[model samples]
Target: MTTEFLSLLCLGLCLSYEDDKENERLSKPSLHAWPSLVAEVKSNVTLKCRAHSQNVTFTLRKVNDSAYQREQSSAGDEAEFPFTDLKPEDAGRYFCAYKTTVSHEWSESSQHVQLVVTDKHNELEAPSMKTVPHVCNPRTAGR
Candidate 1:
């Protein structure tokens, strides 16, 4: 083989390897909810996004909502978003995506994680009441 042909072959192999690595890094990250996906009102909950690649930032987005939360991965692959005193309005589907600092390109969004917020009263049974007997006549108090 000519020296020029060998050089070209080596360059092609190197580029292919780099593309594979980038594709792997751009894969979606996994999302998890703490305590449970179903939570009570006024309770605290945490959503964790775990990335397969290191040195990346994770973004948490709620479906149909314009706001998004971002956090840098610590110890290289995970970030957490905490919700304090959750309310009924907080219940919804959420997604997480990650982007490596080097490329600054976001990966495809992860599978949706649904958060169901329930009122505390909804979990309890109706209270029972007892009737009390009346001992005094209605006219007696007027005198």
Candidate 2:
């Protein structure tokens, strides 16, 4: 009877250990973020992108088929793109993409950002006449 009881206790311990291991595996959650686009005319616009794992390679592509620019996220698994000194010719669709080294999978791109850069001088205002202010005449109130 003593030997039988000891075997049962050992089995219970093994089962508990297995349960703990399973729980540990289940606790790790999946991470991922879709890219987001921002319409900005030069001078730094943050293009947001996220990854589910650590050490992700973030990149930006000019939709007009320009060269791809890589951005590493030291701040986290997210990254941003800043376009400086925006010119009208720089206007185009842009996309953000990220891939995780751990998973080796790339997240779906964020919505396309349509950057429409208009010339500063082209954005002008029409001249307007200034209106003169009139003082309230209390004597004319009753009349």
Against the hidden true structure, what lDDT does model 2 obtain?
Answer: 0.57
- The reply for model 2, stretches above 4 Å from the true place, is 1-42, 52-54, 125-143
Instruction: State every prediction's TM-score relative to the real structure.
Output: 0.67, 0.49
Model 2 is weakest, by summed lDDT over 10 consecutive residues, at: 25-34
Write model 2 residue lDDT over 1-143, tens digit each, in one string: 99999999999999988666444321122222222232334444455555554566776667767665555654466665655666666677766766654334455665676766654444455325667889789988868
Go through the candidates in order and give the C-alpha RMSD of each one to the true structure: 9.3, 10.9
TM-score for model 2? Answer: 0.49
Best by lDDT: 1
The candidate scoring highest on TM-score is 1
lDDT string, candidate 1, 1-143, tens digits: 69999999999999998777666658788988998999999998999898888878788999998865555566578888999999999999999998886555788899999999988686565435655887888889778
